[model samples]
Target: MNSEEVIALAEQGILTILLVAGPLLAIALGIGLIVSILQATTQIQEQTLAFIPKIVAVLLGIVVLAPWMINHMVQFATEIFANLTKFVG
Candidate 1:
């Protein structure tokens, strides 16, 4: 493919990745922040205190957002495949 086409594909791929992963990452970050604050206030500095909640939040985020994420991924893949002819000589 040409440079512009390659760049477009790359941009679409990155956006798809961000769309799929953004919610879980945001949830994990928020959970970690809250857990850190709680640990600071309560002096319960156990590592698992932060770790477990972030994991749980991410898992829950994934579970809750699975359908949307899958839809985005599928759409992206469909677009890429549909454009496969343009990518080849």
Candidate 2:
């Protein structure tokens, strides 16, 4: 592919990644921040306190968002496959 085509593909790939990951990342960040604040206030300082909640939140988020994430990925994959010939030649 030419440079312009490569750049376009790269941009699309990044946007797709961000779209898929944005929600989970945001949820994790929020959970982590809240846990940190609570720990600071209570002086617990337990490592697992922060880590476990974020992990649980991420897992729950994944479970809840699985369908949307799958749909987005499938759509992107389908588009790429449909455009394969153009990309190759």
Candidate 3:
């Protein structure tokens, strides 16, 4: 493929990745921030205290978002595979 075509494909891949990951990452970030505040206030100083909640929140967000994420990924993969000849040739 030409440089423009390759760049377009790369951009598409990046956008797909961001779209798929943004929600879960945002959830984890927000939860982590909250946990940090809580720890600072309580002076508990437990690393796992923040870690577990962030992990669980991220997991739950993933579970809730799985269908949409899968659909986006499947669509991207299908388009890439279907256009394989165009990309290769």
Candidate 4:
């Protein structure tokens, strides 16, 4: 493919990755921030305290967002595959 086509594909790939991962990452970050604030206020610096909440939040986020994530990925894949002949030539 030409440079423009390659760039477009790369941009789409990156956007897809961001769309799929953004929610879980945001959930983890928000949980971590809240935990850190709580730790600072209460002086409870348990190593697992920060981690467990973030893990749980991310897992829950994934569970809740799975369908949307899958839809986005499938759409991206479908677009790429549909244009396969154009790319091949």
Best candidate, TM-score: 4
Q: What RMSD, rounded to one decimal, does every model reach?
A: 0.9, 0.9, 0.9, 0.8
lDDT of 1 by residue, 1-89 (tens): 88998998899899899989888888988998988988899999798768878888888888899999999999998998898888886
Stretches off by above 4 angstroms in model 3 are none
Candidate 2's residue-wise lDDT over 1-89, tens digit each? 79998899889999999999999999999999999999899999888878888999999999999999999999999989999998999
Tell me the whole-model lDDT of each prediction, alpha carbons only: 0.88, 0.94, 0.94, 0.94
lDDT of candidate model 2 versus the reference: 0.94
Q: What is the lDDT of residue 44 in candidate 2?
A: 96
Query: Per-residue alpha-carbon lDDT of model 4 for 1-89, expressed as tens digits?
Result: 89999999999999999999999999999999999999999999897889889998999998999999999999999999999999999
lDDT of 1 at 40: 95
On lDDT, the stronger of 1 and 4 is 4
Candidate 4 clashes between residue pairs 3 or more apart in a chain or in different chains: none
Looking at model 4, which ten-residue stretch has the lowest summed lDDT?
45-54
lDDT string, candidate 3, 1-89, tens digits: 89999999999999999999999999989998998998899998988888889889999998899999999999999999999999788
User: Candidate 2: which pairs clash?
Assistant: none
Candidate 1 Cα deviation (angstroms), residue 56: 1.1
Better of 2 and 4 by lDDT: 2
Q: Where is model 2 more than 4 Å wrong at Cα?
A: none
